[model samples]
Target: MTDTALTSEATHGVALSDVAADKVRSLLEQEGRDDLRLRVAVQPGGCSGLIYQLYFDERLLEGDATRDFDGVEVVVDPMSAPYLDGASIDFEDSIQKQGFTIDNPNASGSCACGDSFH
Candidate 1:
């Protein structure tokens, strides 16, 4: 049976694509971590001055906003929400690129490596 994907309306200025949600769900299941959430953040320090942060987090910090896509939950800190507004998280399982990617409309420019933006 194929699992259906349900995306929650963006409350933290971001959304996860169906493929991304599926990948997250599969990963969480593999890790056996139903208590963890996908955390997205933007921190200063990349070559372009800002970089994206993605990880599984078990702690809920103050001012953190969350949204659910299917069974996967994603968290975004208040400081990073603005930068990630309207961004979409996607997953690629191809031979060329096999990982999570962020598409941020708010980015004016990005580094050649695609790891940082300004």
Candidate 2:
């Protein structure tokens, strides 16, 4: 596979659909934390080369990068930024599956289950 250098502009974080944003915002409210941001990271050691990690963060690490979209704050670590560049986050609701999904153009091929990627 061809390796391309992913840029921050290309991956300034992800886009959230209205339903996804609403769900996240509601969860935040329930948590009673107003200063929290959604954190996404690409970690090694999955079936593929990388796996996604998501959580609510109130603090920024030394090399953490932050971006805003649709009134939502997305935080990513410096190490994970390149792999996640140009990735889009979307919400899906169906009888078979309902959750947030990532559409990453930078990834040439992902794992069979779609939980990991190279």
Whose lDDT is greatest here? 1
Q: Which tens-of-lDDT digit does each residue in 54-80 have in candidate 2? A: 889887666666777666778888889
- Writing each residue's lDDT as its tens digit, candidate 1 over 7-36 gives 123359789999999988998999988999
Q: Model 1: which ten-residue window has the lowest total lDDT?
A: 1-10
Question: Candidates' lDDT values, in order?
Answer: 0.87, 0.77
User: Residue 111's C-alpha lDDT in candidate 2?
Assistant: 91
Task: List runs of model 2 lying over 4 Å from the truth.
Answer: 1-13
Give per-residue lDDT, candidate 1, residue 105: 96
Among all candidates shown, the one with the greatest TM-score: 1
Candidate 1's C-alpha runs over 4 A off are 1-10
